[model samples]
Target: MTYVFNPTYQLLVLASAFAAVHLLASGRTFIFASHTILFAALTAVLVSHGIEPYQTTAQAPGGLWVKLFYGAAKATWWIGGALMLVSSVRLFLIFEGRPREGRLVQDLLAGLIYTGAALSIVAYVFNVPVGTLIATSGVIAVILGLALQSTLSDVFSGVALNLGRPYSVGDWIILDTGVQGRVVETNWRATHLLNGTNDLVVIPNSTLAKSQLVNQSSPDETHGVTLTVRVITSRSPTQIQQVFSTILLGGRHTLREPAPLVTMGEMDGQSIGVELAFRVADAGQIITAKNEMLDLIFRHLKAEGLALATSVPNLGVPLNITSIGSAAADPSDQHDAIRDVPLFAALTENELNLLTQGVTRKTYARGTEIIHQGEKSGALMVVTRGVVIVEKELGNSRIELNRLSPGDFFGERGLLMGAEEPGFIRALSQVSVLEITSEDLSKILHARPDLADDLGATLAARLDAEAEYGVATPSMRRPLTIAHRIRHLFQL
Candidate 1:
């Protein structure tokens, strides 16, 4: 005789198992809770209809409602229990911080367990032969497989991907067919990607499994970017390398550990190609970093008198002086940047234009050392854009004296005093400054003697203020007064 279970008692035990699974599962795995609720509903229907093992719908007494409820409960109970069991296993893996990539395996195992149990119950309790049920199930499976061929392809492809583990969720990927985005979700049928434009792109698992993909976020987030530009052959390779290295080393987004590399690339008759390769903090910041690098390169070439190579009327012809400076920088911008300087405000419009003509616009990336203390370069710099920090070395650490933004000026005291730099100057951001050599200032001072007194007073007062603020001001023994130093240095 086969043993039979009381309907109410069996349901209570099954409900308790599902409830325990749901309670122990991690909150991130919502599938477990959903499947548990479904299983509980099925159990409730079976209890209400008094359906149990060995109880058949064929022997139901009177109402159609009673028979319908019994059939529905019987069909759904085993299938719902299988689903809940599979989901519970997945939740357990997730809670343990293990890979949940064996979802297909869990489903297959659950199906096998449910099928074996169903067969045993039918054979023992209802006296149905197991061989006949196997034959019937085989025929139904063949028909369903043919009808759902496309779905099977996706399922198999998804299984392959899970096993391979090419790209996971939150990874940025680029497909060969030009679809680039962050992977948001991967289901059995399709993978959904969220793109830079904030749109969702859904690709079928079968299609993705066959396509070529580049994972930007695999291994690490550090992304390498290369930029190439052709510079005229007039500039030496050493000068070009120095300019490129400075730009890369001080870049805000660039990684310093790998240390950016600058190499001389292909060379033609008129120009030589230069390449700058560097790694940024992450792949997402590449676009912003590339744009900033281009701006810095353009300005640096202009400052160093290196012009970008362009197509000439004759392939082997050299560029003229006028054509060289044309693309190097905009003369109008240089003039405007010069006029905005307060030290030059004492000069007339014509004098300002003359000074602007002599000025060179230099670009410095963030963290670049613009001027070092005790360096003998007496060039005056006027900030046109971005920011810089002024500091002096005190013992081991450097003391920050001030921050200079756009329209601020520095290094004028060095020019007037005829001495080395007093403090260290560093670029705090991508900075552009108009630099005027002392030679250029000397010419303007010779033209107007009265301008010397005004500039000297300004420079001396600035020196005294910086000294008061703990910045090391260089002491040079030369002139009795600030005005004398300005006059003697400018040759007035």
Candidate 2:
């Protein structure tokens, strides 16, 4: 017997079968079971109709039923294709991996699946062969691959970079191009960096693969830095060592183990330059540690009457002499002077006694202003007991030029030629000064013209060197702003 097939019924059967297959592939138990039930019902109906279109003649009794079955099958295929496309999109979103929530993967999968499904649907509707459409797609794919070779390479490279985890977002990296910045985002085509200036930079994935990159913030977030200082040649090696050790110990931010190291970096004719090497948890904290260390060192040196060198204009001949001051009677002062000040030890007892007589002693409490800029110079000050801060007032702000200690001296140039003070001098600690009166200094110059001339020339040279290549004082160095401080703390 011949059976007639209906086109609409056939289409529904095909659609049900396709949907069942799709549900199974997606591993959705409830959907798969439902599709299975629908497929079974269609299969039963097709069988009960006795529609054997493949075996019957072209003009059969159940031709309409056969057509319906075929139509159903076609409809089922389309439904399955749509379900598969949806599953692909869901997978792209749900998959837990690097470049989380990346749009590239989702776009690529959707494009491929939708294009293939849509083409197949159109071909079916027009009675075109599936083989012909697939062949055309293959040819198009080859041409597209060749045309987009560089773009494809970058896409693949981005995948590799993400999987390799060479660096991650918020990490500090130094690229081969010498660009250093924090990673902000990574995509299929490029990676974004937030630079030191807070500017965003987009770098191609291909460039990243070809260039070298240093992940400074990878493996760990903390790093290290260094600080250096210079003291007068008159300062004893032992005293300088002690001062630096004290600074490192007192500093709140410096690391302890593998403790901070102090080394004498250089010996300029009249000064010993020292470098302090220390470890800090973050590069951001380096400035804070440096400031704290400076303050501590200055205060200690002042309380001890150490003298630091100066770099400024000389007002005059600066009394042409060094005074022993009241600290001359203190054994510690005598020991420090003899050990640190070469010029003092170089003189004979009579000369030393005369030099000591010219020196007058003075004390200043902490925060007291010792000398104001523009004031007339009387005697040069040699710090024999405490600390003094040399500052220059610039409009609304006071710029600290340097800190002085026991061996540090100031006012020589101003006293010699009798010029006005070039800046202000304040005490950071209780300061003990050895003051030399201009009258006594004149007498010493007359008695020992050679000594007076040599000392004056040395002081002048020191002043010149300071002005030429002066180190930045604590206040002169820029401080980290609030935004930078927050970023450093959270590593955002």
Candidate 3:
């Protein structure tokens, strides 16, 4: 004869079914395997309760109590199964990496599941019918919704934003309020942005959804950035084009497909303004690229004997011939001394004035010891007016290392390295020098570290090139000779 299951056994079967559903949704193979064992145990317990030789009387209070317990357990099982299904779907969406749309859907579904579970558990425990509890909850929900309308609007707006995909994390956006930044996080109530200064800006999701936004990363990641260069009108348009093209080709960041555009923008009084338009990969690198491009442009122009425009007003006054002669008689002649210095090249009148304040003017007669060998000197000397011979004592003979003219500086190595003078400097002609002490150089460097780095790099390069080639006579004006030029051309 087939055995009829008792109420207690029925309750155990219902609970086991709920547990099995939860385990299946958990999606773990080993955990699912364990759930089979649990299911078997529950079945064994149910079978043992049913097969008991001794049975409780139908009229006994214990039988009625067991029936009530079974009813409650069955309700709990149903509630738990509903919650598990909702939670499982939500978790699956999250794990699949569909956070934008998935999170909102998950939150809504989970909230409903929790509300249902809370009501069901309470009703089951209190012996209240599910229909009556759900009716009461509906009325309470209506009252709460009225009070939280604005807050609810934000929550719903957040959901809309997730679905719309207006902007995602890591995208750079400019809001309608002129606030610009990268999106860092999105939540049910608000979105967070990291501004340029790296400050976090929390904006309401409703506000963001309503405002217009510009996504810099959209369409394409490439951005067109322009650099403007002002050149002297004296430089021919053709030559300017060639020079700019060469510079663009040398730049690592410049895109070749678009070909850097060089347009003559406007003609100013002293300069022919030009705009250099090019495509760059990112906005952050614009400043660095601007600096390097300007440096390269200036260096190329200087090498090509091109001049940039200036806007300084000059005071027209005739020089006193007598004063000029008197000034010429001084150890360092100011006018002639400034002519040959490449370092002073392209400096404006105001810049020259600022330079003069820190410089000491000195005049040297022929054979005068400008710098004594083995002496500690604090100043770097620039040949402003005449030639100076740099000579080092080698054995008994004095080897002439170089002849420096206007624009050339000496004592740089000693000043930079804090070394004693290694060679003697004498006037090849009556020379004038504008001296910059180590202290002044340091102050200038502190004020402009970029200039200091450029100068340091240039000096190091010159030193390396000189060491590779034998030291030349101080009487030689040009640093490079024909043979040196040829070797440089052929050398790898």
Off by over 4 Å in 1: 1-84, 95-127, 311-492
lDDT by residue for model 1 (248-363), tens: 64456677668789999877676777899999876778889899788666544554556777556567656543333355344337765565566665678888877766788898
lDDT of 2 by residue, 108-162 (tens): 6666777776665555533566678788799899999999999988898887786
Best-fitting candidate, measured by lDDT? Answer: 1
When superposed on Cα atoms, how far off is each prediction in RMSD?
A: 11.9, 18.6, 16.4
Candidate 3 overall Cα lDDT vs. reference? 0.61
lDDT of 1: 0.70
Per-model clash counts, in order, read 0, 54, 11
- Prediction 1 TM-score vs. true: 0.58
* Alpha-carbon runs more than 4 Å astray in model 2: 1-135, 146-150, 228-232, 236-238, 249-260, 263-273, 279-492
Candidate 3 residues lying further than 4 Å off, grouped into runs, are 1-72, 75-83, 94-102, 115-139, 249-260, 266-273, 283-492
For each candidate in the order shown, give its overall lDDT on alpha carbons.
0.70, 0.61, 0.61
Candidate 3 weakest ten by summed lDDT: 318-327
